[model samples]
Target: MLIEGFIDTVRPSRNYSEDSVGRESVHPDQLDQLVRQLRIQRNDDARCEVKACTSDLGSAVWDSVSAFANTSGGMLLLGLDQESGFAPAPGFNLDRVRDQFVDGIGDGGSPGRLVKPPSYAIERGEVDGAPVLLVEVAENDLGSKPCYVRAKGVQGGSFKRVDDKDIKLSASEIFEMQVALTSQDTDRRPVSEAEIDDLDDALVEALLDRRKGSKALRGAKGRAEQLSRLNVTTKDGIVRLAGLLVVGRYPQQFLPRLLIDVTVHPANEKSAPGEPVRFIDREQCEGPLAEAIDQAVSVTARNLRTYSTVEGTARVDHLEIPREVLREAIANAAVHREYHQLFQGQPVTVDVYPNRVVVTNPGGLWGGKTLESLDDGISRCRNQTLMQLLQSVPVADTAGVTVEGQGGGIKMMIHEMEAHALDRPRFRISPDQVVVELRRHGAEIPALRAWLGGLSTDPLSDYDDAALLVAKREGKVGVTDLRDLLRLDSDDIRQLLSDLSNRGLLRFIGGESYELWSDEPRLRTSDEQVIAALSAESPLDIHELSAAVGKSPNTLRPILRRLIGDGHVTPTAPATSRSRKYLRTR
Candidate 1:
């Protein structure tokens, strides 16, 4: 089978019209194209599901309702037969099926109500003269998440769409969604398993001394009252999770996984074999958050190998990854990680490779922040209480300065890396975690220049060289990546990419992305893979082709050029435009 995993399944047609409620609904003629796509795939996908409910509506439809609402919204098609290549079902009753679906999703008190807080738009469409019902479900907000079947309740009925399947959500996942809706700080919650005496005497004294200028400490009558006023203790004298994490003598006794783990690998990639042991050094730092951050940094720094350079006739030695970068990366991971009960078992990790160091924490960007916004100094605190406490809790051996709480850690890391003439740290973000990779500036320029020297006779500009390097490293380079790298506007980047594609140095990879061009024919093993992928669905661009073939666009460019020359493929537009696409030649 062709590699279709990288491509999103066919989307419902966008031909839309406003309904009585001002919501956009799909037009009836749109069903024809959608049906053809469904037939070609011969299966359902994440965005659209097919059902052939001809006689009556049942529990299956409600399950999809919950799944679509809980995850990204999707289209639910009724009277479509999944068993027969999604053809219109035999003996389908369009009006009856549509009425039943409407009643089931209505507000409370409806006899057929199946879901809570219904959010959908319905339309009646026909394909091949067969009537069909299309319902577009909307995703619920955090407060209304885990939208479940009314009969099954949230625990048993809640479902989320994972690819083509509707999977039941775990209790912990539901609890996390509920917790996220609350206005209170999650770290301020009392740790019922922890005691007041769990707070370390010296650490607590240090914290109190640091906060001496605060009005809360001055207004308290005694130590207990002082701790309570400072949000370190609940009214019943139980230690709060944030306070325990900051000053508790043994916070891990109650929350075992709230720590940092560090590991040093022998090579750049984990797949490198022949090593007797997986890690050269491994250690888990526990105790309070401040101490854990410090220890993790120390362990990672100590394991690193340094290099020397001459400055002003003097030899200067520098750690592979700077000490400040390590500390900032570790501290950010500890402070910003999600504190919800669902993620309590997951610990922050720092992995040291020969060429880079990767630090990961159990949470993606919170509060709707985007990766592009990091350079803008936009900050969102996932753990406000923990951040507040850390703002005053000085590092153990520092000169009276706090660890890090001003929301400048990312900016500092960027500045430090740029100052050293190293590439800015790269971030990998997902729903489960956020990882930052600090790469060593190891001969990248020399290697890229050496590679480019053979590609062209004319001398290329520095920006062209930089863009090619990015495209080679990252499978493809997009307008956004170039903007960040070159500090150029969208139009300039587009023009530059077009010029490169014209000069045969880069290939436009659809969706405003480009990759390096190649001319080696012996390295064209992906010829069949590309053909197979396009055969399944025509008119895929270099971006989709590269992702599907699991090769860089640079690798596919030469193959595509040869295919077009041999009449095996055709371009949808001129090669200069970023939107140019390729398909099997008719």
Candidate 2:
């Protein structure tokens, strides 16, 4: 389902009736609550928009509406003004403006015309008792896309929300949208520029040998037959882009952007988070997908750390980031990248850094995927033919180990990282790119220690200090977990985490329940026997709190009383209370 449908599913069933205003009465929804949640902040992105009525509201406001519909559908707040940090529009006349908007989005239209086939959900709500118009636009059916403004035709009026800006559709982009609507799989598109002879014979032979070993395809016969069976190429000898990319001598020679660019950068201590970056080792892989993934991995491994640690008997070598992760990232990018839209100068880029590696592929999450949905390990291939071709290249030693096997890639990547004692990889989406940032915790100790060393001396800053100190002691920190230790609310925890991340003290791991604060917990207590287990910020129930500290509540009573009497601790309840929980006195 599209994002709009997903949002709609969460909205409770509402029976509509005509209000005096003649508009369909939308039953109670979180729209009012949503207004309250986002009233004070200004973050207008692809998923959100804050529109204050202008004199020519129909033209300007409708453009954003069309942009939202053509791309991912988003919430449209009409009475929210950016000048006052998205506060309710000043001197806003709710009834007149709502009527104007209702008429503007009308289908049998003319007076206040906008949106060709009006497919927007408008709700009247209030923010701080000031009426706010919340309009939610649904993404158009892929076939009838380029949801345009009434004045300007589809070619001129179509707009897509890219990051913060609503970019007008170029001629090529409009064409691509049409193609995307018509075609379910882009990889099957034939490469008219290339011939049958363009594909490398050796790679095809190797693939055939691999396929012959697989139980599913053991009976598969000739090269052409195998390619046809796998849907890699057309039966009429028209080489598909997928077939060419998988085994062609040079895919980029025909398809210029069908390649991966690998860059390894030297560790720069002075490079700020937001700055023009520089690279040391640069290599471009334009060969067949089989060789390109291998080449990219080999080049990246040069800069990656391979340190040794002592086990019980001897030393064991450990590469900071495992090779399987690199293969999975690169292979996935090549197999599933958007091919309908021409790659505008940006090839798939793999940036190798000291503490982390960022692999960026051009194209947002494909087929209506959000980050949470992608984490569910569901596979949606943007390029099915290419994926089929990739699955043919079997590992030499492993009898039936093919490169492009279906599913489990994400699970494998996660499991590999965890088994290596590293933080899980994070995935982020943008209008033009999909970024995967994988970090190595063992390599981040030096940076954590440096940040800890530069701790501010002032006494008033101890709260921040205590947070970081605990992070330095615990590998990761969650806000709710710190409620007792810091006596802070949700807002305070959010602000503290933001501050630490800004100051480069903590790296943020993904969060939903509460923001998890991440850092290296290498700095041990003076005894140094083991890493310190983190204490709760908010006092948990007795059993949970005791388990966190690895001691029974009865055993901790004396320690709790002593600390409370000494003014270092306080009990939320009476001393004899069964529900007693302790908080650090800060």
Candidate 3:
């Protein structure tokens, strides 16, 4: 067999030269030299024998490979044998040896003999006229790990490489190896019966509706059918992790610590004196995943405040917080939480403040991911089953949301907040928890209040506040011009402008598409001077005065009538048009 061929390649040499074995060339001379050097030291680190042509030595070869892989990885020479006398060693047959080795490695029935990384390559060379196969083993950085070797009539033993020889690993090494293999699966045991029936029907229905477009969900006719289609059932017809989280009647019954705690504290409490920091409100929401999310959002919305905007002559209340965005963030926390990572009594928490809302889950991010890569579409879900179930729920639309997986909840939340000129949510990951904070409408910076104080006194609407900040820094802006600057929709821009205009804080320049705004004091004085200048230049008509003063015709008519009634201006007929005009009654 090829094992014999690989063994034959191990020829004894005259000197114990390590440099000769380390050479890059796989030439016949170099292989011979390497083989000779290995024979001198009995293959002590300088070289090792690999039997690629024999089935009898399979276990031995695997043990040797495992030793090298667990310690410092190295090369094993196959298709060669140890030289007995050293009288110009003879070459071994190479035919069929490579195929035999490949078949043995690929055998599925073999226990504790899985390929490493699977993409590693092997090569063949020659030594002492004998065919030599080189099996390069790369070290596993997963620690000084111990790997198992399969034996015929007995259970496999843990092996490691130590002091240039393959030896049985110690008890401590074996224990560590067992721990590494079982840590991830230890927390994923089957769910209990008490929690099985706790699945929420509403959440299950929502999940089924979302799965209507999925190819995997095509066979399911209803909610119960879809649950089975998603493999969310155990052998006893009990719900699994997916069902327990999405539809369970009492989700906290299974996961007692799954509920989120939301607390609102006074703003000054962060650095308050001896007085105890008072909480505005505190609520604990429980139930199926969807219900908990709904409760959390409703509570948050009830506590939030909406600012009124003066649109034209009327004031309208616009939603200060984006309900859809807040809901998505809460859902993401519920779905991505590490249910198995909790220890004794701690649970997930969501803290709502006047300026920001923080959603924190128990457990750090999975899969070596970093904050920079959070928005890069790379995700490692700790609760994949939970994620899959949540993805099937239609609580919110995540289209254009860039978070990984079909559940773009995080991405959607960020996008919505940004679209409204709010700061992007801040994410923090600790060894025990992951927290995401979403800023409110005007809480982008602490200096926002100071900045507003520097601006005019007219109560600035949210959009107007954003526009004034942009205009102050950018210099001179129009209605259409401030839209891009403030990241507001066209309607929002129009409403903001109308609000400013009604407060006598801003005025338009004639009937131009682009209108300029001046401070209220400056504009009021300008209006008075413009009327006087027009009256002195000529007996101007009301239309001429309205056009020159940049006021709406209807608005100008009321103002002109008031001025005529007050004896500040008099009515007259212009020569060009038969219509009445206004002249200063100085």
- Candidate 3, residues 1-586, lDDT tens digits: the string is 1223333443322232334332443446555666666666654462354454333334577667666666555566666544452222233334344444344445323333533421123555755545555766555544334445544211245556655567776543444343332334312345765443566666566656656678867765755566667656654556776667666778677667778677776672242456576677888888766667878887877777665555566777644567887776776676666555333255567777777778787655555555666766555666666666655555434332212365345566666665445677899864346788877754434465555645555455556665555445455446566554555687777777766666644555444122235543233354475456566336876567667877766777666656656567777764355677667777
Candidate 2, superposed: residue stretches over 4 Å from native: 1-56, 70-94, 107-146, 160-165, 169-182, 213-233, 266-277, 310-314, 344-346, 396-404, 442-586
- Candidate 2 per-residue lDDT, tens place, 516-553, comes to 24343322232121112323377655576567767777
lDDT for predicted candidate 2 compared with the true structure: 0.65
Question: Over the stretch 1-586, how does candidate 1's per-residue lDDT look in tens digits?
Answer: 1112111322322232234321333454456667777778788888788889868876688888888877777888788889987878998887677667766776323754454544676666676777777777777765676678888877899888888899887766666555544554779999998887789998888878888878877778788988888889987798999999998998999999989999888778674566677788899999888888889988988877665444455666667567899988888888888888878999999998878899999865666555777657666777888888887788887755445555677888886665444678999864457899999755454454467776676666656766776787787888888776666788998898898899998886578987777664322356767777775246888998888889899988888888877677788899788998888766
> What C-alpha lDDT do the candidate models reach, one value each?
0.75, 0.65, 0.57
- The best candidate by TM-score is 1
Of candidates 3 and 1, the better by lDDT = 1
Best of the two (1, 2) by TM-score: 1
